[model samples]
Target: MKIISNKGGKELKLSFRKVLGVAFIIAALICIYFAFLQQEKYIQGNAEYKKIKQTATDTPSDDSKHTQDFQVDWNTLKTQNPDIVGWIRMDPSVNYPIVQTKNNSYYLKHGFGKSYNINGCIFMHADNKSDWSDPNTIVYGHNMINGSMFGNNKLYKSKSYTEAHPYFYVYTPSGKMTYTIFDVMTVNDATVPYTIDMQTKEDFQSYLDTIKKLSTYQMNVPVTTDDHIVTLSTCTNHGRQRFLIQGVLTNIENNNRVGGGD
Candidate 1:
């Protein structure tokens, strides 16, 4: 009887081990499947974006004065969704159409086409001017795990990355403008970067100095009240804190300009 009981206990232990092993295999497979699905979704999204971009570029515009001008097909995009404001492109990652509404929440779960997507469209703060004319235009996007949207935004935390990729471009109906990154920092979501009420030059400069001082990397770029600034804000590890990539409008190529070559 003792021998039989010991044999039964040994068999039970083996069975339990087998069950755990199967469970682990199943969990791993599920994780891989979801990862693949996310990857496919990203690829499909990029393809759609490229298609729209190509069509926009191919369509001729009557304004041939600025031969090197690159303008989004705002007319067509607006027809599909009137909230389409502009497009932003940054190397090594971020390139997407910017959208806006009366409030900031809608695009957090919707794409440029207004389709529901976990990787929400990049959008500007509701209070910001759609023409990128605000003193401090703020844009927000998700820090997706798959490195889509602003997933790679945290790359700016490294000084080397900031030095290598110092500039990004924002395109509006008026023209294309380049912004040189001046500071990148992680701060509370309610910090000064979110403030747009700096009416005085001194006030704005003070705000700028505060952010510049908070930067992890030091930069010599000059920022002035005359310059239009864009702030790209995304989530950091902390729930209430955000990572900000702040840039100053360095150059503008108005569609009306006539004598420049790229």
Candidate 2:
């Protein structure tokens, strides 16, 4: 009886050890699975951080700065067109998709319909100033969330903001251009003029007058008939309002300017 009891005890102990070992293996696998999941989240967060490093033009949101080292070699990536000269940098992160394109979103890779409105870019020939390719260009961008997309709407309340960050540079495959920000305005289409005639001297003057009246800050910019104007617009007030920021092209030839956009 004693021998039989000893044998049974040994068997029971061995069974318990086997059970314990199996449980440990299962627990370890669960832990490894969770660790992998956490790594994926970390990767996504890092991508977001780098993507938005330069969303703000003036101040550093956290510790990162908004300027990018300019390289004209990237101009080869730009679609070929005289009217669609080059891309402008507002901050290194946000490259205002430069183009003379009214039909598409300035050769932008994503955003537009993918992240913004589907009707990305369309030609607008405002009356006097120039065509959609006019020296002074007025184009609208869709309102996007993350605020970094085309959240140009944020400019309306930023009178002090624009003053602090007053200029951005343009880099073309062929030449570089400089621009000084002069006006930031918010308006609803008071006159439903066609987009083609939007730049007509008469229309442009009215447009100028309207913007000046709505300007939150005083602008000392001298925009002659010769200067090129580029306006970036986006939705505001839940798409009820539009925000406009205007700048005159300095036509800086010989690459005399330092460009990273902001």
Candidate 3:
């Protein structure tokens, strides 16, 4: 009887331990599912929020509604961002502002929250060139979310997409400017000419040569040492390559009424 009692007690304890283990496993699975759901919700919310905020800007409103006071034509891009030269507009346009960041921290900092794409995202330099004034300004963004960021970057690869959307409207903070898309290139990240070698005439010339050699755009712009430019960089090929589109400052003369083109 004693032996039987001991054996039964041992069996009961083992069964209890097994039940607790199963409960733990079930709880862990539930937590993982909720985490996934939350992440999806966050991304969706971010896309939606940006759209809504842009509606407020798109609607005609008082001049004071703008971040700056320089715009006469409310629709003008110059009035939008004093530092912004032009914006990238897409087919399935987000109906919102293409976000601008002042640092790489936006993604890591959750500046865009769930809307942020870790695969590719926007980054900026506080003192780097602005689209309007600099002969060559560099604005960096990413492509991921299965190429949504730079994935559509491949859109430029299509000759038809290039022909259909030949002109990308650029509005500089200095004033509204137009950038005739003249160059597109997929380059190694090591060729970091845009970020470096801006200090001297020699450096700038080398930078220009590198781009000219690699440009996929058939048409060419007359870029002089005096000319300012804009460089849009995004990650491609899983961060191994950089998809870059460069634009020259063209016809800046049309943007004077807003006191731009400085």
Candidate 4:
């Protein structure tokens, strides 16, 4: 009887081990399945954006007058989604249509096609004028792991990256604007303030000084209260911190195609 009982206990232990092994395998399979689904979602979102880019944007010819002139067909593009305010491009990595809504949260989950997507489209701050006339226009994007959106934004923290890609272009409905990157920094979201209403020169100058001091490297790019700057913002670590790339408007080429929010 003792021998039979010992044998039964051994069988139970083996059965328990089998159960755990099966559970582990099942869990792993579920994880892979979800990961695959996420990857597929990103691919689909990217395809949608690529279609928009090819359909509505083109490279400027040699005769183009502006250094940063990239032709954008705002008329046709807006028909697809009127929220599109402009096109933001940083060669070899970042290029996407910029969108602005009444609030900033919509584009954080939606694409240019207004479809639900994890890799949301690039967007302007809610308070920013869609015309890009603000003293400091702020742009926001998700730090996608796949290097889409503003995922490469953090790379600007490296002086070498900025040296290689010194400027980024924004094609507004009215013109193509060139912005020279001056500073890149990361700050606690709560510690530093972000504002679109720098009504006074002193206020704006103070804002500029704060960011310049926070910058990780000195590029000696002259920026002052008079300059119209663009701040490209993205998350660093789950939104607790924020990474910013500040660029001062160096040049503007008016194409006379006027269309944007007030």
Q: Which candidate is the best by lDDT?
A: 4
lDDT of 3 by residue, 19-92 (tens): 99999999999999998876775576456535433542333233212222333332433344332323343332
Model 4 CA lDDT for position 108: 90
Q: What do the candidate models score in CA lDDT, each in turn?
A: 0.78, 0.52, 0.53, 0.80
For residue 259, what is the lDDT in candidate 3?
Answer: 22
- lDDT digits (tens) for residues 150-250 of candidate 2: 55447545666766666765555455666777887666643221133444577666656655677766567787645667776666764466666777776
Q: Rank the candidates by TM-score, best first.
A: 4, 1, 3, 2
Count of residue pairs whose backbone atoms collide, per candidate = 0, 19, 14, 0
What residue runs in model 4 are displaced by over 4 Å at the alpha carbon? 1-5, 59-69, 190-193, 256-262
Worst 10 residues of 3 by lDDT: 63-72
Winning model by TM-score:
4
Over all chains combined, what TM-score does candidate 2 have?
Answer: 0.55
TM-score-wise, the better of 2 and 3 is: 3
Rank candidates, lDDT, best first. Answer: 4, 1, 3, 2
Q: How far is candidate 2 from the true structure (C-alpha RMSD, Å)?
A: 11.8
TM-score of each: 0.83, 0.55, 0.60, 0.89
Q: What are the per-residue Cα lDDT tens digits for candidate 1 across 114-168?
A: 7767777889999987878888999999998778789988888888888878887
Q: By the lDDT metric, which is better: model 2 or model 4?
A: 4
lDDT of 4 by residue, 1-262 (tens): 3543588889999999999999999999999999999999999888988788678876444322233344678888899999888888774467788999998888898988888988898999888988898998889989988988898777788898888778888887778788898888787763443677888999988887777678777677898888899988889875578988888888787884422210
The TM-score obtained by model 1 is 0.83
